[model samples]
Target: MIIVITRPDFFEGEAAKIAQLLQSGRADLVHIRKPRASQSEVEQLLFSIPTELYSRLVLHDHHSLAIKYGLRGVHLNSRNPEPPAGWSGAVSISCHTLSELSECRRKPYAYMSLSPIFDSISKRGYRSAFSADDIAAARSQGLIDERVMALGGITFDKITEIKEMGFGGAMILGDAWR
Candidate 1:
C-alpha cells in the first residue's frame, strides 16, 4: 500500500494519462501538491480522475478548494498552524521535529509527514535531516503515533526500509511517479 504524492514540477505532460496510471497502480494515496496552481487547473485535473479514485486523492494546502470541489482533503505545511475548521475530509500535516510533531498532534489532521529520512533534493534549504534511527527515536519518544508518514528523499528503493521503520507510508515527490 505505497502512496504516491505528486509534485507539479515532476509531473508534466499527458496529465490525464498520468493520472490514470497513478490511480491504476498500487498507490494508497495521490497527493496533488501544485502550490501555485489555479483553482480551474486543479478542478480540471481532479475531474479527470475517476470517482473511484477520489478517496485516494489529496490536495496541498487548499482546504477551501478541496471543500468546493469535493476532493479528499489538504496537506498543510509547518507554517500553517491549524487546519481550517469544519473540514470533514482527511487532513495531513508536514512535521520535521518532535516539537512540530507534538504541535501537530493537537490538530485534527488524518496523518503527519516526518521528512528527511534521507537527504532530499527537493528540500535543498533544510540542512537538518533525519535518519531512520532519528525517525525511530521520534516515534519511541511518543512525538508521533503510528500514522506518521515519511517524506523527503523517499523513493521506491527505500520502501521496504520505510515500512520496517514502522511508518504508515512514504510520500513521493520526484521518485516514484517520475
Candidate 2:
C-alpha cells in the first residue's frame, strides 16, 4: 500500500494526529523523517504511538534509536551503504537514479525509495531529473523492485496515477498535511 512518511518540519507537534491518521488507515506506513530531532524528541514521539501500530511505522536515519524505541524499521539515506553488521530488521534506502537502484538491489534491506519523481516543495532547491515515464521505463526494464515507492511532489490526488504507473506505493510531502 502507499505510505506517507511525515517530514518533521511540516508535521511537528502533530505526531498524535499522524498516528491517528495511520491508525485509521489514511496511510499505510508512517515514517518519521525528522533530521533535526533530538533523541528525546524521537523517544517522546515514538512513545506516543500505540504498540499495536508499531508494525506500520518506521524511523529515518536512526536505526539504533528505532530499535531502542521499539519501532518497526528505518529508511536509510543514500549515503549509508549498509546497515551495521549483525543487524536483523526491515531497512529501506533512498535511491534517485538507476545506478543507485542497482546498488541498493545488492543490499539486504527490505525495500528502497526512488524519488523526486517531480520537484517537491519540501525540497525547494531541487528539481526532478526524471519524468514519471522515465521511472515507468525503468520499472518496465525490471530495474526497480515491486516494493519500490515513488517519492517527491506526491499528493493524495496523485496516488491512483502513481499506482497505475507501476509503483508499489508513493511517499508524499507538502500536500494534505502540509
Best by TM-score: 2
Native-referenced Cα lDDT, model 1? 0.71
How high is the lDDT of residue 127 in model 1? 50
- Candidate 1 local Cα displacement, residue 75, angstroms: 1.4
Output the worst ten-in-a-row residue range by lDDT, candidate 1.
Answer: 9-18
Tens digits of per-residue lDDT for model 1, 1-66:
466766665344535644665667756778877767776777777766677667667777555767
**How well does candidate 1 match the true structure in TM-score terms?**
0.82
What lDDT score is found at residue 10 in candidate 2? 41
Clashes by residue pair, model 2: none
Q: What clash count does candidate 1 reach?
A: 0
Q: Write one digit per residue (lDDT tens) for candidate 2, span 1-178.
A: 6677776664455767777778787788888877778767777777777777787888775567766656677777744445655556688888888788877778776777887887886778778878767877888887654678888888888888878777778887677476
Q: Rate the local accuracy (lDDT) of all candidates.
A: 0.71, 0.75
| Clashing pairs counted in every model | 0, 0
- For candidate 2, the per-residue lDDT at 126 reads 75
- Regions of candidate 2 where Cα sits further than 4 Å from its true position: 10-13, 78-81, 84-86
